[model samples]
Target: MSESFNQEQNPSEEKFTSSFPPKPIVEEKSQNALRRSLISLAIYALMFYFLFDRNIVYIAAILLVLIIHEMGHFLFMKLFNYSNVKIFIIPLLGAFTSGKKQQVSQWQLSLIILAGPLPGIIIGCLLFWLNKDLKNETIEMLYSSFLVINLLNCLPFFPLDGGRLIETLFFKENYIIRLVFGIISIIVLLFLFAYLNPILLIVPVIIGLELYNENKHQKIREYLKHEKINYHVDYVNLPDKDYWLIRDCLIFSFPKKYNLLTPGKYEYAIVEPIVIQQINAVLQVNLNPDLNLFKRVLMVLFYIGIFVGPILLFLLNR
Candidate 1:
C-alpha cells in the first residue's frame, strides 16, 4: 500500500505530446503493426490454400477482395484524421481496420464502416457488367467473391460492417441492447460456422469473450462515471494520476489479470503493459451524435440501396 500519489516519477514520463508520443516509438509500433498484418495475411492465405481451397486463383481473389475492402476502411479512417490506423487479417473471420480518435464523429464512423463493403460491391458490380461476354474463371471468382463477401458483411449483425453501422447509429453504449444484439449475432455466426466451416466457430467464441469482458467491465465504467474520472481522452493524453487511479480500479475490477500486481505502489511489473491495454479497451470513444433521425434513416436506406442495385443489375442483365 502506498500513501498519497507519488510526485516522484510519472509512469508515462517519456517524451510525449498531447496527440503523439516520440517519433521512434511511433515508428517502431507502426513497423510492428505492419509486420503483424503481413504475418496474419500470410496465415490467412496458407490456411485458405490448405484447409478450404487449394485453388490459388480463388485464394488470391479472396485475399485481394479482403485487402481492398479493409483498405477502404483504412483510407477513410486516415481521411478522418484517426491515429494508429491498422488493418488486421483475422484468418477465417475476414479483416477489420482499427484506429483511434478521442472524439469520434458518428457520421464519420458510419461512413468508415460502409466504406469497407461499398467499394468492393461497386467494383464487383462493374466487373459483373463488363464480363458479360468474357467467360474468365478468374474474373468470375473475383466478382462473385467480392459480391458474396461484401454483401454478407452488409448483413445487420454485430461486428459486421452493417451491424457496426447500426450500432454506431443506434446502440452506442447501451450495453444491455448490445448484449442482446451480440448474443443474437453469435447465434447466427454459430449457425454459419456449422454450415460453412467448423473452424469458423472460433469467430463467435472470440466475440462472445469480448462481449463478456465489456459487460464485466461495465461496473468499473459506472464507478468511474460516479467518481468523475474522464476517459474520453486518448491514452497519450491520459493524465498520470488518472492512469494510476484507473489501474487501481482495474485491479479491483479484474483481480485475475492483475493478481500479481498491486494497486497503489507504481512498481513497474511485467503486466503493466497488459493493464494499459485493458485501460485503453475500457476507455470510451466519445461519439458525436451528429446524425438526426431522418439522416440515419437515409443512411440505412442507402445501404439497402447498395444491396438492391446488385439484384436489379442481375435481373436486368438476365
Candidate 2:
C-alpha cells in the first residue's frame, strides 16, 4: 500500500509544460463596423430608391425587422458588459452589429452569433401570420422576402452571423481552417446556384477567391513579422509561458506602433546574426484545450449544418 501510494504521489508531483502559451484577450478596433455601416447605409439608400420608395409603409416594416435583429446582438453584448457596439442595416442582407471584442467562450460566441437570426426569424413568422389577411401581392412578397432572407442568412457562410456562429461553435483552430471551410461553402453555393441561376454562382466564387487571397497575404505578413527574431536587451530572459497572451494584448493596445525597431535606425540597419546551440533550454507555455465527447458532438453538428444547409435550401426551394 505504501509503495503504491508513493508511486501515485510521485507521478502527480511531476511538472508539466506546454508548447504554446495562452492567447491574450485582444481588443482591436473593429474594421467591420465602419465598412459594414457605410455599406449598409449605401444599400439602404439604394433599396429605398428601388423597393420602398413606392410604399413608405414597407420601409418602416423592414426597418423594424432590422432593428430587432441588430438589437439581439447589441443587447447581449451589453448584458455581458462588452463595449463599442453599433448596428447598421444592409438592404437584403439584414442587419449587423460590430465592435466589442468579448473574449467570449465558445458557448457565448455561439449564442451571440445565433441571437441575430432568431429574433428576425420569429418576427418574420409573426408578420406572415398577422398580415395573412392582407392579399396585396407587394405586401405578401415583402413578407415572404423577409422570412426567406432571415432563414437564408442562418446558413453557415463567413462574414454572415451564422458563419461566425458556426466558427464559434467549433472554436476554429485557426484562420486557415476558416478559409478552407469558406472555400467549401462557396463550392456548395456554386453547385446550388447552378440550377436556379448560373449567373449567381459567380458571386460565391468571387467571394471565396477574394477571401482566400486575402488570407494568404495575411499569413505571409505574419510569417514575415515573426521570422527573424532580434533582442534589444543585453540579457535575454526567456518569455514566460503566458507570453502569447501578453503579445496579443500589446498588439491590440498599440496596433500602429508594435514592431521591433531601434530608435536611431529609421532608414533600416542590418545586424550580424548570432547562433547559439543549447541542447536543453527551458521554455514556458500554457495548457492545451481539454476537449471531450460533448465538444466533439457539438463540432460534428455544426459542420453538418454548414455542409447541408445550403444544399437543402436550394433543393427544397427548387
> Residue by residue across 1-318, what tens digits does model 2's lDDT show?
122123232211223222443222334455876687768766775677685354656665666656767778888877766667778765644567864442445555556666776766655555555655665676665666566656666767766676776665564646578778788778777776687556556668667766754553343334323433222111133333323322322233223544452221112112201101010011111213444559857765764554465446446544
Clashes of each: 0, 3
List per-candidate RMSD values in Å.
Answer: 6.0, 13.7
* Error of model 2, residue 162, in angstroms: 2.6
Report the alpha-carbon TM-score of model 1 versus the true structure. 0.89
- Highest lDDT scorer: 1
Mark the 10 consecutive residues where model 1 has the least summed lDDT: 16-25
289: Cα error in model 2, Å: 7.4
Per-candidate TM-scores read 0.89, 0.53
- Residue 212, candidate 2: C-alpha displacement in angstroms: 3.7
Q: What is the C-alpha lDDT profile of model 1 across 114-223, one tens digit per residue?
A: 99999999999999998888978778878999999999899888778888988998988688898899999999988987898788788889999998778656766766
lDDT of model number 1: 0.81
Whole-model lDDT per candidate: 0.81, 0.52
